[model samples]
Target chain A: MAETVDAGFLVRWLVAVAEAVDREADRLTELDSAIGDADHGANLKRGFASVTETLAKEPPASPGAVLVTAGRQLVSTVGGASGPLYGTLLRRAGKSLGEDGEVTRERLAEALDAGVAAVSQLGGARPGDKTMLDALVPGVEGLRSSYEAARAAAEEGALATVPLRARKGRASYLGGRSVGHQDPGATSSALLLAALADTARTEEA
Target chain B: MSPATGGAAAPVGIVLVSHSAAVAAAVADLARGLAGGGDLAPVLPAGGTPDGDLGTSSELIRRAAKAVDRGAGVALLVDLGSAVLTVKALLAEGDELPEGSRLVDAPFVEGAVAALVTASAGGDLDAVVAAASEAYAYRKE
Candidate 1:
């Protein structure tokens, strides 16, 4: 049977992302301390917390509404590049989802691709720049297959970011020192994708 | 402040978006001083995260941009990093600003002062944005 995504699914996915971000916040911050500000974990934690709370309070009627609300919360709550970047990702994707009652996996993939494109356009950082695009690009590509595959691709892309010289964000300020450090944005992005995959799996089970 | 001819508000308003709220406010103050410390134009500071920490907030930028807009339009001057991203995100999310508002890519401080001075003199939205953009090519030498 084909899997479908709904408003409830999006809400659960956001909750899973929040939980994952909370669990990995310390590690994310530590990674950022190497080449960028050491607030990646805390920032994401706070942003996702607000996202969950808003989701509960408003209870969007559609998947697009859920994603848009989550994105808005992130944009308002998170105090770093990650806020707008990730917020744009979800918001763009949500906009692309249209007003469909249930979204197919193919539609989800296409929307995710749009979201990743928005991140690239907003930040002007391509895959090799060692930003969130690193994980997001691959994650979108992996969506063509299975959620599990997308999760793996995102994790791999994030890991691949290590050893790349920073070319964007605060890490770029470090120049050569930015080399050999995994990008915090990419790491957190990967974690968020992984949470999405986990949510998919749980729903299927 | 005396209104313009026909009792209309200023032709242009200004918004300073920075990573630090204090920085945004300070720059607005400096720009206001350059505009003769009078209410020549509305200058709003939209900076920092919602919690008052360092970082840009798109929500804050949108609110400030709206607050300063007086039917003519608003000029947005942004600092480095996510301040630009936040504004871009705001645009991408379809949060429409008042008609004639624009984001000018110029040095934050210099562009703001130039834009403020021009707007204070009754320059239109396009002219104020031009002033800010022209600051990009300004040479210190």
Candidate 2:
């Protein structure tokens, strides 16, 4: 089982995510530009950077607070479609954190469900929309299944984006042209799931 | 996103240095995806706003600096050239930037990861960003 998360660990966790985004931001944008706005990577980077800034101003007392606050920040800072979607993910997950300072498997599962639901509500897009939802929905489900399972599911979801026609967000503007390209959101979502698996494995040892 | 700045009640502030926001979002997705029920830190980007470029990331640093607390200064990690100059401009622009705030230019990819890993290992934003800056050496090599 994962050890209880402390403030330092939580900070690092958040930072790690930022770093991952930084590394992949260009790729995400490239995928997005192919079918969508091309701003997904940049937009998300900005939103998270803002979240980091906001959090620095008022560091959360617990893990839940941190996620929730970051979520809220993302929603507000990110102007495009993604801001709200990602914002919901963090906000809902944060809520599940409850008053407890630490995170547990059960709590995380519940929080992730809430996050997924929030994304569903915000985007009104289903699993096959060729959006991040494609990756995210499966990712949360995978987390429940097992870290490795979730990672595999997420990867599958990301690849599945290849044939999808965009039904939501900027990519949808492309019509049939969106068919051959993979959804940026789904691709990034898959990466996220994969990263989580990596983190779990790395942390385990 | 929010412009609110620091005080005793603030959180540890973070600086996000990337080529653009799209990349930033990807990182956020990665962060969210990897979240195993832990707290993810707040990070603001030094560049790319739908409205404008934030007029040289220096402004971003200035604003970010004031946004946090005494110990929580802005930490910078950039994606490319001129961003270094931009950060310098921001630092030179005024006294508003907290003494705690400093620029961290690490290899874009490796720096972010190293900083993050360091942060996970119990380093502060300053330390994490610093580690990230060190990773910039890889770019030089």
Candidate 3:
């Protein structure tokens, strides 16, 4: 299987994720409205749309540059928490990718680890806090194991949100009430991880 | 388009209002992630927490408001009921509050990005906030 991920593919994947968010934005917002501010899907959609436009207009020279640019754009353009967090994730990962527009499997792993660390630093949320970290951390870890493992872990993380107490973010305000609902951030994080796994798998074939 | 056409050239910052500290922090991280590095200064104020209770929300809002010290202004995005009330209380109680800071209805992610985009693209704070509010039904990917 190929190990390197080219910048073009990375941009395409980001665009795909953005497109997915746009298409499913209403559902994402509806889910968020239940316990959040009712804007997860909507917010991501707008950010990604801009990301798509920016990437299309002037594609970055390197994978890290692409992600960093996207992250900066999201930070400057996106107003909410997810914007920065996701932006941070991409930016951190991008930073770890180096100047080369392509990433080896090892580089990918390193960049993802950097992203997870950045996310942890920015959010201060650990696993079981019912946040995106739950899904993202496991998803990144799973990449070292196998794509199937990563997919399953991400799915499990998303499902696990239903039983969590939502120790962080908007859903946590509900207190015990947040127990039964899946965290929108975590769910979305899972989707992002799943997309990465999908991309890796498809590219390998 | 030029900044003139987009909106005013207002220096903008982010406001993160969630129900919990972890969520606020996490959301803040999300915003930071989107910003790539520290390109966008994000202000995270979780409305409440399981342990911290909701009483401190007003203080958080006040602190977040202070972070948006630029001449342009700060945009506030809230998550839930008490959180909203707490932010509103802070803004109302402040006699010397900055003219640039105000709460507007914008979704968690969309609003922040819209604000950032508008501001970066040369839109004013108000225009950015207006654009951020479009997070509710923003077009898909």
Candidate 4:
């Protein structure tokens, strides 16, 4: 399990996320319309598109640089709370990774834990808050084992949000009305982790 | 810090953040207009996205904060939701905004007026912030 990921691998991972967001934007918006302001999908779509564009224009030199650049791009372009929250997540993770030329699975897991913590701190949210943390907390925990495990855990966490009343973000305004709908942020978080898992699997193959 | 000639302390600067570029600018103008005819303090507006859409942008806020920083601390007044969140993100980045900068929780329009009047009178950051926050208790009935 010592397979290492370089700058190129991180770029591929972000591109994968961009593609996934593009493919699922409508579904994400549908989820948001149920309990939120209905801009999560568009916001994420723009943010990832900028990430893809920025990476192509001038690729970063290391895994840390890659994540940092993508995170900053998201913060500047997303135009919503997701922008800063996701930006802080990737930026903190990149900072934790330092300027490593290649990152191992265990190292990436540790970095992701730091990233998730930053998100939680920025949002002041816990795992039961029906926010992205619902999926992200479990995803980082599972990453300590296998990529497949992490992906599965993230999906489960996202699905689990359907029954929880919102305690954070715009959705919280709806109170019990938010219970029946799947959390858009958690759902998007699952997509992001799934892309990470796919990228790791491809690298291993 | 006081001037070499022992003049009054530098007045605090003010910044307004909002989702719409026009709203931030309008609010800033309103504050300045109502601040009375004195050596007015710097009141800058940072609103909307780079695309000029209806959302806050750190870049715009960054530029506004920098432009209005005059050795005195900067006081930020923000509109609802994303405006506050985006400014908080910049503040958390540390070094993105000027030192002693703070986000004051107050009503958008009324707070801006109170803050600007206090700042123009050479009020320190604390006085400026208190004025804005105290605007909430003003009876409108």
Candidate 5:
């Protein structure tokens, strides 16, 4: 049953993110090299590595603090558009959770929605813009049903970005040339959601 | 954001944010030099990643804005896309930057020159931002 999750659950989710990003780095970088800058993989890997380190060193009391700390670390470390975009997602969602030690599934869903909205507001992007929001919007929406639904929706959203012309970010500069390439941001966003769903299923403690 | 070093009010401050640390620092130098030296307004560069790589750092931008702030407001000139987003992120942080500091969308070099020159002459924030923005239309043949 979808019940409540604790800070340890969030930490496990982030650790899953670090592992996923590390494993998928080459693929993400390959996608980026096709349409945008080629640093996406390395940037995310570095950011997640730092997140792993910080969460280990000085663990936060609440899930909100964990996310806020990780997000701020990414903002400080990562150095690209992804840094702020992803950072805003975690930070806003964390803020929405409001220092809760354990959060219900419904609350987590709402917080994630807020996080996605913050990303949209920050980047001025929509689903069709071929951005991280492409995955995130649907991912958070599907969380209303189940974790598996969210993961499937996010993967589908990422795949949907392949043919869309980028209307935002550095990829937009490529115009028609961007059509055939899958958006790296969308790809990484799906990875993040997958980490969440996986964490929820296996790492419940 | 203190009011100048001495006396009442000083010229509006300027910050050049570029993806390259060298570019930001050099632009600050170029603008200050062209504006008859940076004796009046505070001109600083917030650029590069934390590791001094080619990317914008919000922490760097925030620190530079704070450093250049002189109670007259800070005018930030960004070089490229991510640089703008980084500043926007810092602005979203709610109090990371001093009050009255704003990111001005203008050509990197020309805007820096115009902004610093206007600021050096003790221009207000509005005037300095106007000068930088107006530099977008500066004719080049």
Candidate 6:
């Protein structure tokens, strides 16, 4: 089994993400309605739609190019803070991949770490703040193990946000009311990592 | 472009980023009106999502920043949350903007007006950004 990812695998990963987000759009929106503007699902749906369209329009030659193009589309299409946060994630990760034809798992993990750092820097949100960083930080950390482990870690991290008070984004405006609700951003981030892990597993199989 | 060669061609530009399209355009209009509607600094509005919804678009900001950038540079003022994130992401994409372009963290309306007024007076990019940042200290009391 190959331990490396390629552009084709990345494309499939994005497709999986789009499909997962599409399926869970309503759930994500429901979560956001509690603490956010109730647009997380719709925003990501639109952004990922644009990404798929861009991918179909101009197929990227490299794995880095694929992620970069997807990031640009998300930044342009998605509304709210999630747009830039997700966009920066993929863009920074793509840049870290450099011009390599094949991406090693270690390289991908390193790139994801950089991407997670960029998200924290851009949003000023930390793990306990009940933002996407809650999931993303642990996801990146788990990448050091295996894709399945990363996926599970991301899910756990996202679930951990349920007990946290919001300290960032629109949710923060709710103060104490933000507790006891799962963060929509963290949930969506978990989905993203899940999609990546699924893709990796499928490719390896 | 350097501020040392200031002229009509090298005036500092201002960009207003907001979640609402109407808000951004209205603020730009208000700033322009305050500047007497003459050859004041170029004020561009990069507001809303690409679909005209309520959200910030980095692509739109990048376009507006490029359009308004003459030679001096651009000063960007954002409204809350994702607007700032979008701008930061755009900047982090490496060498996307011309030299000296910056994002000013201040009150959106007041900062836009102040930055525009300063730019209209031939202020450089740093000066325009400073004016916008200084608006944070302003109190209505």
DockQ leader: 6
The CA root-mean-square deviation of candidate 3, after full C-alpha superposition on the true structure, stands at: 15.0
Per-residue alpha-carbon lDDT of model 1 for A1-205, expressed as tens digits? 4478899999999999999999999999999999988988998999999999999998998888788888888887887888888998898888888788799877899998998888888888898999988998998899888898889999999999999999989999999999888999999889988998998988877
Give the C-alpha lDDT of model 2: 0.65
Q: In DockQ, how does model 4 score against the reference complex?
A: 0.65
lDDT of 4 by residue, B1-141 (tens): 332122356667799999899999999999989998979989999888888888888888888988887767888999976787777777877778987788998999999999999988888888889999999999989
DockQ value of candidate 1: 0.72
lDDT of candidate 1 at residue A4, scale 0 to 100 = 86
The C-alpha RMSD in Å for every predicted model, in order, reads: 2.9, 18.0, 15.0, 2.5, 2.2, 1.8
What is the lDDT for A11 in model 1? 95
State the lDDT of candidate 6 residue by residue for A63-141, as single tens digits. Answer: 8899889998888788778988999999889988988889888788899899889888888888899999999999989
Interface root-mean-square deviation for each candidate? 1.3, 12.9, 10.3, 1.2, 1.1, 1.2
lDDT of candidates 1 onward, in order: 0.85, 0.65, 0.70, 0.89, 0.89, 0.88
Ranking by DockQ: 6, 5, 1, 4, 3, 2
Regions more than 4 Å wrong, model 1: B1-9, B37-39
What are the runs in model 5 whose C-alpha is more than 4 Å off? Answer: B1-7
Judged by DockQ relative to the true structure, which candidate is superior, 2 or 6?
A: 6
TM-score of 5: 0.94
lDDT tens string, model 2, A105-149? Answer: 556667888888867765667888888889888778877767788
lDDT string, candidate 4, A5-114, tens digits: 89999999999999999999999999999998888899999999999999999999999999988988988888888999999899889999999899988899899899
Clashing pairs in 1: none
DockQ of each: 0.72, 0.02, 0.04, 0.65, 0.75, 0.79
lDDT per residue (tens digit) for residues A69-145 in model 5 = 89888887787899888998999999999988999877888998999999899889988999999999998899988
